[model samples]
Target chain A: MNDPAPKTVPLDDKDFRDQLVAIIPPLRAFARGLCGTRDMADDMVQDAMTRAWAARQSYAAGSNFRAWMFMILRNHYYTTLRKNARMVSWDPEVAERVLVAGPTQQDGLNVQDVQKALQKLPAEQREVLLLIGANGVSYEEAADIMGCAIGTIKSRLARGRVALTALIDGPAYKDEPSDKGSRSPAISPAG
Target chain B: MHPQDSITMPEETVPERGLKSVKETVIASDDPIGKALRRLHDEVVAEPIPEEFLRLLGEIERKLNGAVTPE
Candidate 1:
């Protein structure tokens, strides 16, 4: 197991609260990537933080508190997922529309495109990618948060990267054949 | 602590493939994908902490302080 051994530390409420507050942004960002919208993602973060605070006694000190909190957030997300199975947004296109709305477009088209590409990934793969690529979380920590082996986390990262690349660059390739006027869209869109 | 933690971008280790060149370009320091991901993190960090969230945190703080629970 890649899990860190829990270190002993007398619980300091002020320090604990500071740590919790510090992680809110990344926590919310990860949630946004998972749920595909700011409001829904913040709701997930709120729920997870509440649960984490309530269960403070169970949290081990000096071990990876971020990962522990992430697990809580992920668990809440999945529980909510199970409760409303029908509303799971399967269509990436639709997801892109929903997630990008309300957020200011001041970040430029590149950010916008990447966000869209991210939502295009499968939830499992997307979560791993965000945990590693975006949030700088370790694979071991991610695997622990995700309740999977490190190898599984690696595979998801690989697959997610490939899919993201394809989605991001696919349009340029599609335009090439059409611009050449020598090939049709259906035959060479993904090439 | 795990070896995989050292592995940030899998493309660095994965054998060269048809998309290897393109993938390298995409993951480059100045690449949009990388920038976008960074921007996402930055934007989140820049956002003001919501009052509702702060209130929630205050509630937790109060509870942690052993304050009597208000019915």
Candidate 2:
């Protein structure tokens, strides 16, 4: 017969709340990367933080804090807004037109184009792209954080890049008009 | 903390000269995405963590110290 595992020191509510607060910055940063707007992400994270704090006993000590917290926040985000409502614009009819709109064919690659293009990507693809490409998170880490397979992360990253490239090359993205002598020198992509 | 917080350009190539004119010559680098990517990165750096977030963090901290509820 095996003995029951030794007990550890119990965390009072205050200690648990402190732990949740400490993780907020990175949590907020990650949430921001997912939701596309600061206000929504903060709201999502705050709700998750509250939920986690209230259910503190469920979170085992010495576990993956970032991953656990992220799961809760993400769940809150999804539950609050279903995919359809979120994809639509404030103008009800605009959502229909927006669906068929691909990247404009002649915008010329620029940051503005990229941002616009990214907005069109599916939420999953966007999440993977932000986590892996912009934020420099590892595939395994993202997979763990997202509760998906590493292969899924790689696939989303590839697809997201392709979609973004198409948007950059499309006509909708307008290049910033620059004067002959005043345009800033282009920096290398390698940088 | 928004989803687009770090959204950046595709990347570009830069010449030795810091002058804006030099930017006209370089596009993406061998890496192909560096130019746009770097600019976006700079933008992210420029964005301070939103004050509302800081306020919330402060509030949470206070709650931990027995100062208030989730306000």
Candidate 3:
């Protein structure tokens, strides 16, 4: 046989199969965060999962399996984007249409506002923010998945947080400066 | 499937460099914005996986097993 078998037998090992199944939740969440829609995200997840299954031999045993799956998902996304001759950009207003605003706000922070603010961030920044902040991946793993330096991931995350905060907390800051004379040191664009 | 089979794998130990912050003002997880994002993340994670995806997994499994001819 020209092609040898993979060290980790994906179908034979129940543990591996179970592991793949368990990662679906985070995989779907990451895809949705990247795609900005449930249907598109699920499509991406399905594609990624299929590819992951076919290429299971490449996966290193005892490594970060979820990270590997995430890398696959990201690669699938970028490949599809390239094939379609399109690139994803950040649109601040996209999430505003989907969020269900409740009559009561939690701790004076609205979920819809947060979603809208999140949508405002660039795709790179949002991915870093969600990967580290939301999806619970470490910077190193996120860097490996995103194919960037750890420092870059950190920088994007920091910028994403600042932008999101400005969008959510100070909605009018971008349009109308409350006081240009008095600058609040807490939130600044220099970082 | 055994009840214990569904137990999640332990999280990988974080690399020390993973904790490095790019800026002094990096938002803490306890911050209002951080909390909100985490809540959103939880909500997304809690969303049910569609039946179509489950079916896809079955198809992949069957293909791996050679039970279905490759189209």
Taking the tens digit of each residue's C-alpha lDDT, what string does model 1 give over B8-43? 322111111111011111133443444567676667
lDDT of 2 by residue, B1-71 (tens): 42222222211111111111111112234333333433333344345556775776677676667744455
Candidate number that wins on DockQ, 1 or 3: 1
How high is the lDDT of residue B12 in model 1?
A: 12
Query: Mind giving the per-residue lDDT tens digits that candidate 1 earns over A1-191?
Result: 69896444534667778889988988988887777767788898998887777666566555577777777787777777767764346455555554333344454446656667776666676787677766766666676677667566666666666566678778532111111112111111011
DockQ of each: 0.13, 0.07, 0.12
| Candidate 1 residue spans exceeding 4 A from truth | A1-10, A90-109, A171-191, B1-32, B66-71
lDDT of 2: 0.51
Give the distance in Å from residue A140's predicted Cα in candidate 2 to where it truly belongs.
Answer: 1.2
- Runs of candidate 2 with Cα error greater than 4 angstroms are A2-25, A87-109, A171-191, B1-46, B67-71
Expressed as tens digits, the lDDT of each residue in A1-191 for candidate 3 is 47875344233444556777899988887787777656677898888777777666556556677777777777777666656533354444544444333322566467666765665566666777777776766677776777666555666666667677788767543422111122223222223
- Candidate 2: give its CA RMSD in angstroms: 14.6
Where does the lowest 10-residue lDDT sum fall in candidate 2 chain A? A175-184
RMSD in Å for all candidates: 11.6, 14.6, 11.7
Descending-TM-score candidate ranking: 3, 1, 2
Chain B TM-score in each of the candidates = 0.50, 0.39, 0.49
